[model samples]
Target: MKLARATFTPGVLGGPGFFGGMFELPGGYLKPVLVSSCDGVGTKLKIASVMGKHDTVGMDIVNHSVDDILTCGAAPLFFLDYIAMGKLDSALVADIVKGLSTACQEVGCALIGGETAEMPGLYHGKDYDLAGFIVGIVEKDRIVNGLTIKPGDAVLGLPSSGLHTNGYSLARRVLGETPEALSKVYPGFDRSIGEVLLAPHVSYFKTLQPVMSDVKGLAHITGGGFTDNIPRSLPEGVSVRINTGTWDVPPVFELIQSLGQVAPEEMFRVFNMGIGMTVFVDPSHVSTMLAAMPQARVIGEVTAEAGRKVEIV
Candidate 1:
């Protein structure tokens, strides 16, 4: 229903082989500003190929991109995907599309267009890459650029649903990429290692809607984890001071830390360590936001001091 209304003509044009996607949005007096972001699923695809699970990676790309634009206070409108592989299989495409459609519907974003290619010279058997481009809209006045972020503001960390599409290369190097190795279950984890590693990334768009006004900035912790991502959402003179023991670091990270013999600081730099998303919220609204969203907790604060972007204790 959401997609059909925004599409220029449902199923008539747009998607692979078409020149482009046609979308219609009814603009009002609010003067909606468009926000867009593009991202790839990264080396996580290797794990998916080994496990023969193509669905979740599709979700990973969409959710990852959605969260990216959400930092700008935009609500996702539609999404487009690009998939390239060596051999194209109907079953494989179906699984991947299923995941994309599932994620798009969940967030009310239209999965109106996408491309799938078979490149024998470039990719090998089931090995492929996935990328997503998302466009969202927000009122210009409502943009959260972190300019308003300052000292005394509370930093809240949202629990991640496992790795959330990052640190996979190092994880692969540590956890072993073979089918048998992934199938091995370690102590404390009831499921196979592959399942934990393959878990799909979470979407915070809808969940953060209610408290959007109170949030001054948001950092989608990816690629560089807390160290790199948090700074992107901070102003010049302000930095984050995270209370390390505030939230439970998921066991999967501990497993990687132990098995890979990774140093503590490197783990925080390379992975989320538990928090998938961080919010710089107004102190006055902190309690209300926390009460509204039980899964989130006070993880740190904004410091007036400059220099280091993230200070962990």
Candidate 2:
């Protein structure tokens, strides 16, 4: 695990002690555009609080924000974070920053600076909230915004780390948050429920960089799951048909559904079910995309449908 420090980036002018981080765009790119995205760990932090684990949620905030901007084919440059707590717990703050630095190194992003606040009234004891902001660069000609997506374009599925920082409020509602409940190892699960739910969000920046040209559009399946998210990348008069059977849904999702009796559609609407990020490509590039990324699955196709944004069949 590496820390985001000046050692990794001496070119960074003002880092920890300055009012802001200063960066110059690295040489050798043409018409580069900066893409930025921000996100929080959400109620998923509640699980981390209950479990007494602080670091993974830090990774969650960075990875989640990084992936959001990655949809437009951006490479992370620098990241800043906001961690708010009731009291300034030095050990806990250090643990959280440790996770953020490790994730920054993993994505080749600089952890420039951040803010930590201790508000006794706003936040309860030991409870904290985490959010991250990331800025990335991409060539103007290389932005993948799905404008070229057509009816026959093939869809590719990228698997998710369980939960991946979304739908936690509902997840906590269905799955008890008590110490005993979090520790329960369901029949099909090897790790306890808490461990599965707290798995850090996956960052697609490194994995998809090489194959980005093979894709015409990208969608990061986050808060809205398929129904609300897939459409953001789609052109009008066209919708996606997701082949749910194409990949295996993780067991934790099944546990949440079974315990809560959540409807099938609601489950898909809330959690990712399985797929995290989706890649759209010309039908001709299906083989090329899958060959380049073996872990990806051909899970759906675009159709000439107007009313619905996504159809899970």
Estimate the TM-score of every prediction: 0.94, 0.95
Model 1, 29-93: lDDT tens digits are 28889999999999989889899999999889989998999999999888888878877776887
List the global CA lDDT of all models. 0.87, 0.86
Tens digits of per-residue lDDT for model 2, 106-193: 9888887777777889998778888889899999999989999999999999989888989999999999898889998999898999
Q: Which stretches of candidate 2 lie over 4 Å from their true place?
A: 1-10, 16-19
Scored against the true structure, residue 97 in model 2 reaches a CA lDDT of: 86
Task: Estimate the TM-score for candidate 2.
Answer: 0.95
